[model samples]
Target: MANIKLALVDDHNLFRRGIASILGQVADFELVLEASNGQEFIEKIPRKMPDVVLLDLQMPVLDGTATADYLREHYPLIKIIVLTMHDEDRMVLHLLEKGVSGYLLKDSDPDEVEKAVRKVMDEGVYLNEFVSRAMLRKMTNKTTVVKQSTLYNSKILLSEREKEVLKLICEGLSTAEISDRIFLSPRTVEGHRLRILEKTGTKNTAGMVAYAFKNDLV
Candidate 1:
C-alpha cells in the first residue's frame, strides 16, 4: 500500500517537529509538507496534496477552522485531524460539524495519534474518549436545539436498516463488525453507510455522528 501522505500545520515549531518526528517513524506515514500557519498550508495544497493533515486550531494569518472550511469546500477527500491543546466540548462539536475527521489533544499519547490516523483512514472518523464524552454531554443538554432540516428528519429520511447501521456506526463498530452484528454482508453494510451519509448530507462519519447526536437520530 502507498504511504498515507501527511501534512502538519502548526505555529509552534517545537510541536510540529515533535509530531513530525513521531509520524516519521511509522512506515505507512509520509510527512509531505509542514506549514507554520493555515495560509501557508493552503498555498502549498496544490503542489503537495496530503491524504491527512494534522492542523492546530490557533494560528496566525488564518486559523484551523478557516482552513478546515476551505478543505471541506475544495478538497473534501483530504481528512483533517485537529491537533490542539483545547479540550472544550463546544469547540470539538464545532469542528466535528464542519467535517473534521478527528480531534486529538496535544497531550495525547503518541500511539493514540498514530492510531487516530489509521482509524480515520479506515473508518472515516476517529472519536476518542474525549470526543465521546463531549457528544454525550451535548446529548443530555435540554437547552440544545436540534437543527431542523428535511435531509435530517430520521423517520422521513432513513430506512429501518439504515437507522440500525447508523446506530452501530455511532457505537464505533466498523463495517465488518456492523455486518456481523446485523447479519449483512460487508458490502451491504457499506451501502447502508453511504446512503445514510447521503441522506444526512454529512461529509464523513464524524459529521454523520455529530448530526445523529444533535438531531436525535441515534
Candidate 2:
C-alpha cells in the first residue's frame, strides 16, 4: 500500500514544523503539505489532496470549524483529524458533529499521533479516551428532540443488565474494568457490548454512546 499522505494546518510555525519532523520519521506517513492557516490549506487542497489533514482549531485566515465545514461539503472523502490544544467538551463535541475523523490533544506523544492517524485511515474514526468520555457525557447532558418511541421502535428492548453495561462502556471503561465493576467476566461484558451495538444499530463505541444518550437509555 502507498504511504498515507498528510497535511498539517496550524498557525504556529514551530509546532507545525515539529509535527512535520515527527511524521517525517514514520515509514507509512508523508507530510505532503503544510499551511499556516485554514484558507491556505483550502487553496492547496486541489493540488495536494492529502489522505488526512491534521488541523488546529484556531487559525488566522480561517478557523478549523469553518474549514471543516467546507471540506465536508466539498471533499467528503478527505478525512480530518483535529490536532488542537483545546480539550473543552463543547469544542470537541462541535467538531465531532461536524464529522471529523479523529481528535487528539496537541501534547500527545508522537506514537499516539501516528496511531490515531492510522486508525482514522483504517477504521474511519479515532477518539482519545478523554475525548470519548467527554463526548458521551456531553451527549447525555443534552436532551434530544427525537421521541422515545421513534428512536426505539425498531430496536430491541435493552435488558436492565445490558443498560448497566452500556452505561459503563460510555463511561470509557475497558471490558475488564467493566467486568470488575459489574461482577461479570470480560468475555460476558464483550458479549453485552456487541449485543448493545446490534440492538441499537450503531457502528462503534462512539455511535453506541450517541445512540444511548439520544434515546435516553442511560
Candidate 3:
C-alpha cells in the first residue's frame, strides 16, 4: 500500500520540523505539506492535498478551529488530527462536534503519534488520554442526570446482541475487532453496525456513539 500522505499546520517552525523528521522515518507515512497557519493551509491544500493533517489549535493568520470548519465544509475527506497543548473540555468537545478524526497533545510520545496516525487511518477515530479523560467525566455526569429522568428500558428497543455491539463500538472497537470479540463474521458485524445506525437515526459511527452517550446507552 502507498504511504499515507500527511500535512502539518502550525506556527512553530521548530516543532513542525521535528514532527516532519519523525514522520520521515516511518515507512508508512509521508509528510506531503507544511504550513505556518490555517490560512496558509487553506491556500496550499488545494494544490497538495494530503490524506491526513496534524493541526495546532492556535495559529497566526487562522486557527485550527476555523480551519477545521473549512475542511469539514470543503474537504471532508481529509482526516484531521488536532495536535496541540490545549486540553480544555470545551475545546475538545467543540472539535469532536466538528468531526475531527483524532486529538493529541504536543507532549505525546513519537510512538503515540505513529499509533494515532494508524488508528485514524484504520479506525477513523483516535482520542488521546486527556480528551478521553474529559469525555469520560462528561459521560459520567450525563449518565447521572439521565439515570434520574430517563428510563433505561424505554421505547428504543434493541436486541441484546445489538446492544453488545453498540457498547463495543462506543468503546472504540473497530468492526473487525468487534467481530473477532463476538465470534461473528465481519459482514455480520457490519450489518449490526448498519442496524445500530438505523435504530439510532445516526448517519455515521461518530453520530451513533454520540447518540449512545446522550441516551446513556453505553
Candidate 4:
C-alpha cells in the first residue's frame, strides 16, 4: 500500500512534535506537512496535499473551525481529524456537522491516534468513545426539547435494506463486517452505503452518524 500522507496543524510546538513523533513510528504514515495555524496550513496545501490532517481547534490565526470549513469547501476529499483539548458537546457536534472525518482529544492514547488516522483513511470516519458519548448526550437533550410528535414525523426516508445498513453503520461496523452479517458482497455493501449517504445528504460517516442521532433514526 502507498504511504498515507498526513499533516499536523497546531500552534503548540511541543504537542505537534509529540504527535509527529508518535505517527512517525507507523510504517505507512508520512508526515508531509506541519503548520503552526490554519492559514499556514492552507497556504501550504498546494505543495503536498496530505491524505489526512490532524487539526487543532484553538490557534492564533484561523482556528480549526474555519480551517475545517475551508477544507470541506475546497478539498473535500482530504480527511480531517480534529485533535484538540476541547471535548465540549457543542464543539464536537459543530465539527461533525462541518463534515470532519474524526474528532480526538489531545490526551488520547498514542495508539488511538494512529488508529484514528488509519480508520479515517479506510472508513472515511472514526468516532471514538468521546465523540460517541457527546453525540448521544446531544441527541438525548434534543429529544427532550423537541416534541415527540415532531420527531416521529421526521420520516426516515430510507428503504428497509438501506435502513439495515445504516443501523449497522451507526453501530460502528465496517463494510466487510456489515457484508458478513447481512450476507452481501463487499461491493454490494459499499453500494448500499453510498446510497445511504446520498439519501441522508451527508458527506461522510461522521456526518451520517450525527444526522442519525439528531433525527432519532438510530
Q: Evaluated with lDDT, which candidate comes out highest?
A: 1
Worst 10 residues of 3 by lDDT: 144-153
Provide the overall lDDT of each model, using Cα atoms, as 2-decimal numbers: 0.91, 0.81, 0.83, 0.88
Each model's total of backbone clashes? 0, 0, 0, 0
The C-alpha stretches of model 2 lying farther than 4 A from their native spots are 139-218
In model 4, residue pairs whose N, Cα or C atoms come closer than 3 Å (at least 3 residues apart or on different chains), thus clashing, are none
Please state the error at residue 31 of candidate 2 in Å: 0.9
lDDT of 4 by residue, 135-189 (tens): 7897778645376426543654778888899889988899999999999999998
Ranking by lDDT, best first?
A: 1, 4, 3, 2
Positional deviation of residue 108's Cα in model 3 after best superposition, in angstroms: 0.5
lDDT of 4 at 118: 89
In candidate 1, position 146 carries an lDDT of 57
Alpha-carbon error at 60 in model 2, in Å?
Answer: 0.9
Model 4 TM-score on a 0 to 1 scale: 0.93
Model 3 lDDT per residue over 53-105, tens place: 99999998899999998998899888899999997866776677577888888
- RMSD value for candidate 2: 6.0
TM-score of each: 0.94, 0.70, 0.84, 0.93
Q: What lDDT does candidate 4 reach at residue 35?
A: 99
Per residue, candidate 2 scores C-alpha lDDT tens digits across 84-153 of 9898877776666567877889889899999889877775667678776775676555444246536574
